[model samples]
Target: MESTEVLRISRLARIDLDQDEGARFADQLTKILAYFEKLQEVDTGGVSPASHPTDLVAPVRADRPDGWEAPRDLVARSDGHTDEFYRVPRVLE
Candidate 1:
């Protein structure tokens, strides 16, 4: 990034940067972009995109018998309730 471009971006982002600060940011941005350019040269044709770098799986929980009285009691105490669902006022027209 050139100092001029950095200053323009800073102005657009409502950031105040003097000429020296803009030049410093330009140098840092140039190094960061160069690093990204280096990463672009890597071969990853066989690699699949992932949300995380590690392989993780959800833990399985053992099922136990539970009564339905809890939900019944909660609904009985609630201010709004129907036979199967709670009633809420329309929030949008």
Candidate 2:
């Protein structure tokens, strides 16, 4: 970028870039853009897409017997609140 353009970008973006910082960033950006330009010279032929590089096995979990309570019984065990909401102490200041 031209010096004026770089200065204008810094001001419009509300960023403070000293002379060295601005020049360094501009040079690095130019080099990265040039790298993208070089990538256009590649020829990729007959490559199958793959989600993973190796075979993966599924893990299993041990099942144990634990008596489950009904939802209505659980709600009834709370301190006098309906199933739709829980009762809590008033938090007013």
Candidate 3:
């Protein structure tokens, strides 16, 4: 990676970089790109791509509907509540 390329990348990413910073990033990016290039040279003829490194299965719980009971005592305590619902002031006419 060249300093000019790094400057262009910084501009695209909306980042402000000084001349020294641009040069430093150029060197770092070049090393990282070189490492990726080196990785490309490895032979993986029989190796399969894996989502996870380990073969452990995740434990899943059975899904069942749990019945919900309303708080009838709370509604009874509220001044604005009727039998089961709480009444709010009308917002619009």
Best by lDDT: 3
In terms of lDDT, which candidate is stronger, 1 or 3?
3
- Model 1, residue 9: distance off in Å is 2.0
TM-score of each: 0.41, 0.33, 0.43
Question: lDDT for model 1, on a 0 to 1 scale?
Answer: 0.83
lDDT of 2 by residue, 1-93 (tens): 666777787899999999898898788766787888986687656766577876676677788767777767777788877774667888996
Best by TM-score: 3
Sort by TM-score, best first: 3, 1, 2
Q: lDDT at 43 for candidate 2?
A: 69
Q: Kindly report which residue stretches of model 3 are placed more than 4 angstroms away from their true locations once superposed.
A: 42-93
Per-candidate RMSD vs. true structure? 10.0, 12.6, 11.2
Off by over 4 Å in 1: 44-93
